[model samples]
Target: MRNVAVVAFPGVQSLDVSGPLDVFAEANRFLLPDEHYRLEVVGLEHGPLRCSNGMTNFADRHFSEVQDGYDLLLVAGGPGLVHQEFADEIYAWRT
Candidate 1:
């Protein structure tokens, strides 16, 4: 099974993460039930991630704690995405 890591950060757009998550969930339910991907929500820190609209999202793991073994790492985009720091962090994690 492929391990998928999704980065959830402050000010991230909900749909950016939810859309792909739903698609992956559905694909796992039907197409790849036997050998599907494992999804994990990772944050910069071990706490709640506040969205742009004030929605709070919890993370399963922290970015610093993440080790090797992930097949995919997705970083959601939003209005706050203009900040390059988050992009740099994501790229660092991906590499």
Candidate 2:
């Protein structure tokens, strides 16, 4: 199985996160029986993230704990991404 990580944060656009996910889910249906995407929700911190629409969802892992190996990494964007808070920290982490 290929690992797929979706990076999410507070005020994230719900569709930005869920849209690609829907495609991934659909792809799995057509793949060979031995292949499938293992989707993981990763967040800046451990716990649930609040969406721009006021909905909350939990992540499977924290960004800090992520290691070097991942088939794909998707970053979800929102209005909150314009803020300076956590920017430096996240940039450093990505490097």
What candidate 1 gets wrong by more than 4 Å, as runs, is: 84-91
Per residue, candidate 2 scores C-alpha lDDT tens digits across 6-60 of: 8998888888888988899999999985699988888876688898988887888
Over the stretch 2-78, how does candidate 1's per-residue lDDT look in tens digits? 78877788888888777778888888886556589788888865689888878888888888777776888887887
The model with the greatest TM-score is 2
Best prediction by lDDT: 2
Q: What lDDT score is found at residue 92 in candidate 1?
A: 68
Worst 10 residues of 1 by lDDT: 86-95
TM-score of each: 0.82, 0.86
Query: What is the model-wide C-alpha lDDT for candidate 1?
Result: 0.78
Residue pairs in candidate 1 whose N, alpha carbon or C atoms collide under 3 angstroms: none
Local distance difference test, per candidate?
A: 0.78, 0.83
